[model samples]
Target chain A: MPGYPPAALLLEDSMKTALRKKLLRDMLFARRFEEQCYQDYQVRKIGGFLHLYPGQEACAHGVMAAARPGEDYVITGYRDHVHALVCGVPAKEVMAELYGKATGSSGGFGGSMHIFDASKHFMGGYALVGGPFPLAAGLAKALKMQGRDEIAICFLGDAANNQGTFHETLNMASVWELPVLFICENNLYGIGTSIERSTAELDQYKRVAAYRIPAAQADGQDIEVVHEAAQIAVNHVREKGTPYFLELKTYRFRGHSMSDGGAYRSKEEVEEWRKKDPLEILLARMIEDGEITREEYDAWDEEILSEIEDEIVPFAENSPDPDPADLTRYVLVEDDPYVHGGPSKGGA
Target chain B: MPVMNIIQAVNSALDGALAADEDVFVFGEDVGRFGGVFRATDGLQAKHGENRVFDTPLSEAGIIGTAIGMAIYGLKPVPEIQFSDFIYPAFDQIVNEMAKFRYRSGGQYPCGVTVRTPFGGGIRGGHYHSQSPEAYFAHTAGLKVVVPSDPYTAKGLLLTAIDDPDPVIFLEPKRIYRAARAEVPEEPYRLPFAAAVDREGEHVSIITYGAVLHEAREAADLLAENDISAEIIDVRSLVPLDEETILASVRKTGRVVIVHEAARTCGYGAELAALIAEKALMHLEAPILRVTGYDTPFPYTLEQQYLPDALKIFEACETTVDF
Candidate 1:
């Protein structure tokens, strides 16, 4: 690890104690929230493709930590609950959206896969395989065009790297020197197709390297590793005003979605990845290194559990469904552009 | 009013939008330096600068997907597809991703994307170049489909589409790019989405749109000499269909002939006839007849026979009137 930067380069050494405690709490919130949402799907409280982010807490915490709250933009494919949560969308609003409530982000129109918070710069979770690739490039182009220093972080899956958008957008970003960070949260498999069966190269970062965009890989389960790698990637995009590819090597604890049986991988493989559980790695290391007492960590876990079990769950369940008449809302914005001379009513 | 052709009108529309709004940008394959193969975007890059007017790789999905991102992030993107035939690659981005952004996000995110593509037959561009796919975009919900037939409507509608808050499929009839000159206003104006009655008569109402509007006009003139008064209604917007004008024309004329350059199978003409039957069937003096392109792929050698001409519309009008 000589040429590699230190794991905790982004975080201050003096604030290690405080950071350890906060990082654990952050991961805990995502875990408890996803745990409840999983149950919500079982009882029909949440529907559609309910992909949960139970074990991949570090990837969100570490990668999103590099994103400036209201400046840098973040976009990802589906399986994107924690990214929005980490980006500062209120848990209540995120849950309400999952519950299909008008009070939720996206007015409850976008469910799990399509969370959007424009103000927070968490653009949305694009549902298509590689659709957001070009969108991310466009956003970076917009940022540069408008003379903004902000960059765009596009999170694609391992399987998504094979998509044409990945190659096309990468080349465009490199050619134009647009500010973009293409992060691949390589969780080994895309639903059922593992990286081996899908990509010719196991390293997703190498595929996009053909465009002359520098590439890097990090331990996605380790917050410190992911954060350090993300900081470097984000810095490169900002300084060079071009794109850089980063592959955060990680694994998903849950199935691809609620309905997925996950018959593709063996139980042994899942167990092996579980041993490197992101939450446990930080919790165990922090306690052993005396960054925090065991009691303090347990208290934080209790706080997160109560927050979800008491507050977030009720907020979602009690949230009101959208009005029947308002069903046509958001199909277009306020001004009826077609109203100048077209038909009296638009076809929704 | 300034005399302009469809090509000039479209260019004027793009120039107007680019000059007025800093957020409006245009890009596509060979659109920037080459002025586009059809020159619909000629001189735009020079006037607006490379940032506003630029060329993108020949990837339709890349053009549309990036434009969608720009639209979501507070830019009005007018992405040209080069040709409608090259649009299938970006079909998912345009149809599903771009079209559903507003609805799926519950209105929090409405991407203003005006995808400009040239589509139609009669140019001998064959299967790859000559294709009319308005029905595909028209069938999709949450999309405004505009097919401008002449210069006046082309300039006015493209400008309106660029300003519209939602996604609009602005399909220009490539066959009529330089078809004829028409009186277009020097300043920016918006045309109504409602269909216009191009010619008035009592024998039959010829409901048509896009390139076929020309043939329908000629066919109406031929019908006039034969002592038959034919009315032609141009449906400018396929989605926000001017059902009122079409129905009223059908009721008054008491006979109908539908015309389009797309395949007869599942074409927009079928939708028009269905509407007339459902709404104005009682007023009909004869069953509605259709004059459309063949169901086969746009042919290379026999392109003339594959395309719908004025004679086809006149023959269909004859059958409807005789019935």
Candidate 2:
């Protein structure tokens, strides 16, 4: 696998053909995987809240492409399947987690919202709106305390900025000079509420100025733009050893969750955002640049779809459910006395 | 052994934790430089360096949230909330994130965060300053709720909490921070999360924790004078409750009186009462009574009246024994 290329390599002129192809493939796989999830949810294969990452693929793929997987810590909100995949968590494991199987990433305990792969440094996918803010800061604090060069990357929506923790954590991150990149995937609407209707200041990057942290905004529809901006943001945090905020202007194709029909959005609005689809933008860009033919792109898409069907779906379907007898296993550490039973016979 | 108050003992425990483990971090509001408002972290920053012992912004959520992160990254973070009453701002971090980390992650990340905070009423600090919120934490699963009654238990239990593999809510009885003193071990030692038989007896069993244990001791002394022979059980750890110790005492006494500084409606006392009623009801000869703070908000001038004192505990014990 091609590790995250340096910021200097991500420039439009210097970008490698292979790296560009890999970015397209990764985002294509994510898009297809999420579409599979939508189908699985409809067919009752996957249970619980399923947050699909379709139109906003570039945000996760682009930023993560600039991050060192299995080294740099990454955390995000509930829409996390693609993020976990970008961090090197196996697509099968993520699918298994959605299937609530024992072989899942979190042993089926986390379901859709809490995909975690500590081995890959994918911290987690938190369900709470603003819960990951302080946690991301904490991760960066740990990295700084240990004298490590790795930075913590936190992903959230435009609406999460309204949370008290968002303000509190950002202020603390700046105050402590922690190495963290706060990426706001500004999909315009947090669920049904548009950014204009919700936030007073529409520009999420401007809000970071309050904390005195350096920030930039980029078009999240284009993987090249997203990757270029993320590389700069990542480099800023990594080199300066200070927090940086990067707002990606993007849109999600689906609703907040599987249950949401997105009645709050107009068809014209959805169609308009769909026109700037992140996957199509990258694929079309590569084709226009004479990097690949239409037939090759179609062939790769088919391969990714087949892999999701033949491997990911079957693995999750065949995996066993978590045993009921071991229900309280992870409440504490395995060796903890309380895990086996309550208090001992007499007073300590 | 050296004689120290709860504050001194807590300080020593934190000092020992930082000295022993390079990964141990102590931080909170006014903890560094100021050495904490109550001086529990007194002189710690000077001794252990600013990085290990530091103060944080006054955001409780930020403090606990960052601590949770540090713990997830394999550091032992013992963060203070200044006062337990102020811990509500961090309730989401504590209840949802920290408590559920290990379980939700399928044991991949065990958040070993020992959140130290001063709790209980007394010393004239009204509503915000002195509220025993142990019940709130005790109700939360995946968290160990521990209360240190005096100096020795304070140091020992705190060390154990810091060393524990899971998240621990170490609620320090601020009421007895300076008032209660004892000869504590100089070296670091761990105390188990189980009740201690403070005073063993027969007629009546007094179940209590935190600063309220002192009142139970005084009540036991009063019962001794009246030849009641009250067995006092100091429930140091409320979550991993010492059920055997409590049940054994209740079985021997055949009468029980639960006590706590928190309000009575659904206090930790109610859990104890329910436990006794469910498991050891046949051994009981009388109805279990509870001597706890009233079901109202903690009052300022009426703090004395609101708190369950020795007289109240003694009365409750008398009622249980007489019944």
Docking quality of model 2: it rates as incorrect
Tens-place lDDT per residue, model 1, A256-289, is: 7775676667999999999999989888888787
What TM-score would chain B of candidate 1 score versus the native chain B?
Answer: 0.98
lDDT of 2 by residue, A163-271 (tens): 7889999999999999999999999876545666557888888888888998888888988888887888899999999999999998888887775667658899999
Q: Output the lDDT of residue B132, model 1.
A: 86
Candidate 1 residue-wise lDDT, B14-126, digit = tens: 99989899999999866776677677888898899989998765457778999999999989999998779878879999888998999999999988999999998665444
Off by over 4 Å in 2: A1-14, A339-348, B1-323
lDDT (Cα) of model 1: 0.81
Interface RMSD, all candidates in order, equals 17.6, 17.5
- Cα lDDT tens digits, model 2, B134-182, are 8888899999999999999999999999999899999999878899999
- The CAPRI category of model 1 is incorrect
lDDT of each: 0.81, 0.85
| DockQ score of each predicted structure, in the order shown | 0.02, 0.02
